[model samples]
Target: MLDVCVITGEDGPHTALVISAGGVVSDAVAPPGTPHLRPETITLLSALLIGDWAVADASPDGARIEARGIVAAYAQFHLERSIRSLGHIDRTE
Candidate 1:
């Protein structure tokens, strides 16, 4: 699951700041396609997901604001799975 927000630049293009459960962070064109995911809002989300990364100039949506909790929950869930999977890597021998 991906927690994404659609933010339109002052000029017009939309961009998303995304954070993965495994602690990956990046920015990209909003509504990512194919296999890529979108970004999160510029707020506590970035801080919660990563230590120093920050979110900036994100569009404010009341609907999306509420989703932060849900997204965080899922991200944590995924993170747990990722940790468990790492155990298998060591056993792959």
Candidate 2:
């Protein structure tokens, strides 16, 4: 149940790449001509998502950066969700 979102650029839309033990699902909403992620990139992202630092660290610089960016975006998204959900908590005694 690992979800990774990579922010392509300031004006570009984000791409969602989901990886599960069962299989991989991608919501790549990029422009028409945009290329899909490379296999190495996916491997690096999986390693980063599952906390396999050895594999992640051994990846190429570009792949590592891309994967880390995706991981960071995913973390930020979850953090925002957590913060928003806090507003729904019952605070009364």
Which candidate's TM-score is highest? 2
Q: TM per model? A: 0.24, 0.45
1-93 in candidate 2: lDDT tens per residue? 323333322332223343211223334443344434556777776686689999977888777556555555455575654344544745442
Cα RMSD (angstroms) for every candidate in the order listed: 12.1, 12.1
lDDT of 2 at 9: 27
Clashes of 1: 3
Q: What is the C-alpha lDDT of each candidate?
A: 0.37, 0.51
* Candidate 1 error regions (>4 Å): 1-15, 21-31, 34-41, 44-74, 81-93
Pairs of residues at least 3 apart in sequence or in different chains that clash in candidate 2? none
Best by lDDT: 2
